[model samples]
Target: MARLDESARGVYLIAVTPFTETGALDLDGCDRMADFYLEAGATGLTLLGVMGEAPKLTTDESATIVNRVLKRVDGRVPIVVGVSSPGFAQMQALTGRVMDDGAAGVMIAPPGSLRTDDQIAGYYEQAAEMIGDVPFVLQDFPLTTGVQMSVPVIARIIKDIPTCVCLKHEDWPGLAKITALRKEGATARRVSILCGNGGVFLPEEMERGADGAMTGFAYPEMMTGVVENHAKGDMERARDLFDAYLPLARFEQQPGLGLAIRKYVLYRRGVLANPTLRKPGAALDPLSRAEVDRLMARLEKRLKELN
Candidate 1:
């Protein structure tokens, strides 16, 4: 597969790590999930993301999942694996392994320890050096990392790191950041911007200059639909599609329960064998599951009406 670069665009779905009811890795379920994402119109795949439950996986397990998905995808689209770690050695090691295993690139999120703008910019500079020539996506998710990256700091990183090719823009109220980055000579060069936060802010992000989304939602078609319609200059159609999924999207954005909700919805959609999160994770209660069911039913109705 070609390396991910500034030209990358469209929905790069952040995939979930499927598990069996017994909590073992579900390789078959991984295949099924890959097929589902591609069929839903994803242009790329980002695995081992935060939503993929990355920290829970041992090194071997992470490699297993990445290889499994890479073989299944068969180079159909670029595969970006998350390699964020507290240390550069681990990040560089994983980057080498996955890049050797046919991954197009890797993603690195700022650790919460970063406080100053210089620290943020310096970290990416060193990371780029440590990872050698491997292209990387700079994950700017202040909500989870608690490390806010202002537009100037982001531009400095882009200016200093040649291999930093994309930004996973997940900062809340971040539309202005996108606008600032796209302004004349804001950075040394252009970098692709893909919005995250499960794509809730994708329409506005795109309007502000994002290329597309790099997030997970059980209904990825809604994301693809929005991007496609927006690219065609059909803002009203894009919004109508977004509105139909907004209820469930908002429901799934719940902090501790988001992944559980996503897994349950995928299982209900017949994409997963089970919705079992690893230990130290949460699961939906019966009432929450029923509520999700109702939302799914309503989404189905709304989609039908739109069609």
Candidate 2:
């Protein structure tokens, strides 16, 4: 098992699930993507995330994708599988299977139905019991999960659950949350904090004491480079590199349209064979495609200037 812990730090690319033009799972493309991420300086890889089109995959297909990716990666970096199911039964089953198949750990987001602090804390308590010693990342993106976890609430979870090792911190304007968590005596113990808003706030998050990123942006090299420079205390170079890709990253992170933009960029880069989403997923319009192309052009120019 990859078993992520507090000491873990650096870029963990939130992987996209590749598919054929007709919408079937692209197992071979999954292999290519794994290789591309590792070569681009990813310290780890997380799959079946929201950006991976996870909810769209059936159970069998999900297992197949995980198995394929793990095989291709072959333990070069930790592979964290997103096992956020509505039911603990399903979550437990998936976690067990993936761990058996060599995943390093799993990620869980609080159910959207959770509201009050107690409800949220209680839910994770049950989740911790169900998963039983399998390390997990607590995903804290209130925008998507609809369940906001206050700093105290998160501290409580960390205090109560020993296996909760990292956080996928995607709360917008979340720099303060990072600051709060890193404060002395906040959490019972230290846990790795990785922000995930498409790398939009990565520089600030890094400054606020985040470990690194676990977001899906087409140019993961940007995330890797920013984190590397930040670690080396080269703030100027980090900001410059982040700013160069900010335009494309902002364009690629348009909520409902973001995945289409990311997949297209990956396909255009030869990492994905075809930028096809599964059924019920949207495709980019010609106007959107044109917009992405223009952004990509600007990104190239800006990156050259930075260099």
| Per-model TM-score on C-alpha atoms | 0.99, 0.98
For each of the candidates, the C-alpha root-mean-square deviation to the true structure, in angstroms, is 0.7, 0.9
Looking at model 1, which ten-residue stretch has the lowest summed lDDT? 88-97
In model 2, pairs of residues that clash are 2-104, 3-104
Pairs with backbone N, CA or C atoms under 3 Å apart (clashes), candidate 1: none
> What is the per-residue lDDT of model 1 for residues 192-272, given as tens digits with 9 covering 90 to 100?
999999989888988999999999999999899999999899999999999999999999999999999999999999999
Q: Give the TM-score of candidate 1.
A: 0.99
CA lDDT of 130 in candidate 1? Answer: 95
Please give the lDDT score at residue 154 for candidate 2. 96
Supply every candidate's count of residue pairs whose N, Cα or C atoms clash at under 3 angstroms: 0, 2
The TM-score of candidate 2 is 0.98
C-alpha displacement of 244 in model 1, angstroms? 0.6
